[model samples]
Target chain A: MLLFFLRVINYKKNNYYYNKIEGTIIFLSNFAPMIEDKNTPKTSLSELGEFGLIEHLTKNFEINQKSTVRGIGDDAAVLDFRDEKCIVTTDLLVEGVHFDLAYMPLKHLGYKAVMVNLSDVYAMNATASQITISIAVSNRFPLEAIEELYEGIYAAAKLYNIDVVGGDTTSSTKGLLISVTAIGHANEHVIVYRDGAKENDLLVVSGDLGAAYLGLQVLNRENEVFKVNPNAQPDLGPYSYLVERQLKPEARKDIKELLAELEVLPTSMIDISDGLSSEVMHLCTQSNVGVNLYEEKIPIDPVVISTCEEFNLNSTTVALNGGEDYELLFTIKQEDFPKIKANPNLTVIGHMLDKKSGMALVTRANERIQLKAQGWNPIKE
Target chain B: MLLFFLRVINYKKNNYYYNKIEGTIIFLSNFAPMIEDKNTPKTSLSELGEFGLIEHLTKNFEINQKSTVRGIGDDAAVLDFRDEKCIVTTDLLVEGVHFDLAYMPLKHLGYKAVMVNLSDVYAMNATASQITISIAVSNRFPLEAIEELYEGIYAAAKLYNIDVVGGDTTSSTKGLLISVTAIGHANEHVIVYRDGAKENDLLVVSGDLGAAYLGLQVLNRENEVFKVNPNAQPDLGPYSYLVERQLKPEARKDIKELLAELEVLPTSMIDISDGLSSEVMHLCTQSNVGVNLYEEKIPIDPVVISTCEEFNLNSTTVALNGGEDYELLFTIKQEDFPKIKANPNLTVIGHMLDKKSGMALVTRANERIQLKAQGWNPIKE
Candidate 1:
């Protein structure tokens, strides 16, 4: 079992053909895929608890920047900031909008609230430092429950070394709302923007994708089973990787530091809160470039593969469209590829193309297929 | 009217108080007459539009410190942090809770949002410098409305001379929500905390109070009229003072600088956001002291008094309990009292007492009445 675990972990690190997934495994866009077949019953947000949903959502993110200092693991992320420039970002999470509290534990909700803001600061290639959290909660929440929420906040703060400076506590008319602002500092020269990737730059990602989405699928299935028979225990066996990815997603602060250490400045970068396909499109559209990804290069975990097969879903589709992978999708110059190739955590999936070439995918059969983005659009459907 | 206008303009410079109805007058709290009935129909917030409400709320705010280079008037408040210390504060405003969009204009909402955050920074006796804003809105809002909101934001930013450095935009499931974080700096030596007031220190305020609350009442009344008969023009003529108080409130950043130039360092300071009475209570409780506020010295604007009379409410009660004045409530040593006494804008309202004495009010009829806080409590109603 130890050897098997090691092999599974090192599988992507070694160059080996694991399966015959059809879609291109390369530089896809950042949006998550939507399996819009009427046969698959649509689920309402209330069906999955907040924790289960967040776990389902963030399964495939990989942190790629070292300045990310601390990622999804803290109350507020910590960044080295090297010297000079400091940046902070925050967002408000309102119930019925950001998440449904019915399925989300107050603790995980607090944790995820902080993570969402910290993700933005990380996207700037800066390290997060301090945060102020404001919460408006209805009287429905007991003092003990509020304490549980703070426990999660305090735990993440300790893990990230962020100071909980000050915030307002007010009564809300409806459900719970959380707003967190995170601050960080970095050397002005080192900060990366979304508009820096160039044609021919190698597109790379850290770690495997699509597990979080599959994890959500498994949880959803289990939730349905329990609904039918309350006595039925959830069979989450073999879905540990996906479940963990969903529950406590970590930001890619380490990857930021590794890139700096390797002296590889990514031309452009963004965190994969959305799926790989959506994020890739963001990079492409922002940089005014196209990309060509090879399906053979996409990383897929063994558990994800087995789970996808069990669920009768395409592993390639899951990897391509799965969201919340917090992994870094960045482009490095072709000349730096030799140095980056040695990093076990780094995966070179595709290359940037001219805008006219458009975004395409190379299947396992070596046939080129055009790639289109179908991310989660709350407004459209 | 010309003479009155000139006097008002000059009051800005000489700090003189003219008793003219439309000009400038410092409503001394110590001179207010005591009322027999305490149960005056308290004003309701729902009556006022957001802008009118903010204007009414900040009318009497006084700037007392020199380092407070800029107070409530900008995108982010400005302060001279070069020589002193600085502190930053922020808060989030959510629709359906913090405000109702049914009556709020995007422009005023944007301006008021920045002002609210700057108030906290001023409460710390620091001047604001920079601000970052993050907003989440549902699709129900149009692009033009968003632009209007930005116009208000940029207008405040430009007026305050603070750059709109960064912010985040995302979709919300509910109405609009704005979160503003402001940064300010002050001299470390001159920095004042809420807990620094000493026994017998002189209490001072910059301007009058209760107008904002009254303005809220007026707007709410008008709103009700509009709701029933959309064609009914808002009968706001008599309550213009209150309306302005609520619609376009300004921070007293200028007063902070004047205090520095005049060489007065307040022993303790806090913004009268909750109301003069509540703020005094906060300072006294935090400092482990009591206060003796002379009713006659509390500044009550003639418009506020007339409006209060029209509404059958005592001017004294309105001045004492009305909230959102954003005026600085501060205490100074006996020695500084003489310097401020001659100044037109500053009014000595009361003095600190030992903790054993507790907080009390000295009525105009020489009666001792205990002061109680009846400021805005959103949760109660």
Candidate 2:
């Protein structure tokens, strides 16, 4: 099935590659062109080195967070949290394993890295305030490449309204590695953890799922087709949403605000980074409860379903086990479900059960099957 | 000169390699051997995978910090800083670039990773309360090896009285990469910055310098010898201090406490990760002051001096340009110099001057020479 898509893409490449590329160029010309200096001399990283590269990339970032006492150029960035409790989380992204630079733009990579860490902050019912990004890159990456990467990072920081604080830049032996530490602050009373879920709690999720995974599949297939035929200009309009979800997924930052406005506090919460099934297991184990996940209620997009059919994979399976959704998954009291029932962004997918009941998925046929955590595991070959 | 030392080491190896190893074995037998379960079943990382591995490694880490409210098994670690200001700093350490596993024990690597980041927190005159350590390793590493690495990390967390908050562990494309983020807290009134120095401030450094560099040289030489002949047992007793300085370097955690005890606040402060000259330049540029550094007053351990002489290198040059001392370098008012004069651990080697004057070193020959930041530049080929 994947080979058929590749063949179709290759056929389209031979027939309409140039015209499609021209259309894309015309489309992109509407926006401000990204600054790419072809005439500028390529500076060897050794000339500016680690400290200089850091100073150049981070020089423009202003400390916007009132809690931020100091930003870059210090041993440590200082923040005054006052009476608010602080939340901290870190994520490490390595090339070849976590991302393929061939199709992944450096800018998007930077934005996604920050988003992934910030998603965890939001999952805790906290507002992210600051992040420190430490990157190690090989000599293969020119200073301009690093600048482009930081531009994405700066854009994410601005969009999220967070401060770019202190970080270390060093030389790597091979490939680019980025580690982001996000700091957030929340009131002690509102902070949530995964161990607070109770029986009869309604399992709710924000936004749709499985699009990111299918998007990755589409990109992978397109990349394979391109490898075979370099002139391939695969029509990506149909897969644009999925591709965007894969390359530039956003954290459900507004969900916390919405929940606050609705006066519904989650008993237990986690972000869907490793698929809904895996995250459900984590929540259930931590909260010492079982879950009854309804497969029909799993919010998957129509595009994802079509793509999954084209790939000969089950949409339900993809939605259950596909990772990197970055959506909020939490359990609220059954009585609180009414507050979120009218909201289109959120869906009640399941409900918590007693520990003796065990975690199971109720299918459309009304048959129950045990759930397993087959989420994306990069450790496997 | 290096060849002569290698020849001497080879000659010693030819004569007493086995006997020396036997003696070393006897010496090690006196202490508890590190836990190594080579005979046990080897489990591929794929068996437990990422999440399981994280849970297995971090399960035993008890939260010791009062600031930490929620740790591990959560979207993000939560900390209650109350009214205190929080300090954050992050560092990236790549395998071949920052460390070599041949000589660097994984435990020491873990401990050193924590120390390096905590050093920055101390440089800010704050008390470190928590840290998030993210590591990426290639498949070549076994589950046991990762356990050993975390053992060192757990040891450091215990010794420092800090909580292990949260971090990500992922698979790297090639070598190991560790990024650590240290979070600290300090009263708003006592925090220091690098831009606060004024004219006539006394420049002081904690402990001696260049020992870490010399230690690296020793390790590199020993590694080269081992590569040529694995059985060779080079006598390291004479260079033990240097080797320790490199392998198990400690952050000057006591400096902040000592300064508090003496009631002297640093006008400007920075850590000597990059050699003294580079850090001095940072202070001068940030603080808008020049400095007159007395070469004769620069502290050097007797072992470091002898090692430099043996290597046919200038002790003053080594002290000035060598990096990774992890020592605090700061300036204090001239009036406060008397308070630290009797402290053996602190050495006042320079005094701040007006911006009109240039940064210079007064040599032993009574000649003044402009200082250069010829520190360790790993980016250079």
The candidate maximizing lDDT is 2
- Top candidate, metric TM-score: 2
Q: What is the C-alpha lDDT of each candidate?
A: 0.64, 0.83
TM-score of 2: 0.91
Write one digit per residue (lDDT tens) for candidate 1, span A11-49: 223332121111111111221111234454445433333
In order, the candidates keep a fraction of the true contacts of: 0.15, 0.90
Tell me the lDDT of model 2 at A321. Answer: 92
DockQ of each two-chain model: 0.13, 0.68
Taken in order, the candidates have interface RMSDs of: 10.6, 1.2
Candidate 2, residues B1-381, lDDT tens digits: the string is: 011111112112111121010111011111221333446555667778888899999998999788888888788999988878999999888888888776666777888899899999999989999999999988877787788789878988997788998898999988888999999999988898899989999999998899889988987777677667756756777886677667667787788999999999999999999799999988998999999999999999899999999989999999999999999999999999899999887999999999889899999998889989999876764
Pairs with steric clashes in candidate 2: none
Candidate 2 docks at the CAPRI level of: medium
Shift in Å, residue A282, candidate 1: 3.3
Model 1 has a DockQ score of 0.13
Q: Evaluate candidate 2 by giving its C-alpha RMSD to the native, one decimal.
A: 7.5
lDDT tens digits, residue span A1-381, model 2? 011111112112111111110111011111222333467555668889777888898998988899999989889999988989999999988998988776666787888899999999999999999999999888877777777689779988998898999788888888888899999999988998998999999999988899889988988887777777765657777876677778777787888898999999999999999899999999999999999999999998888988888999999999999999999999999899889898877899999999989999999999999999999887874
10 residues in a row with least lDDT, candidate 1 chain B: B1-10
TM-score of 1: 0.74
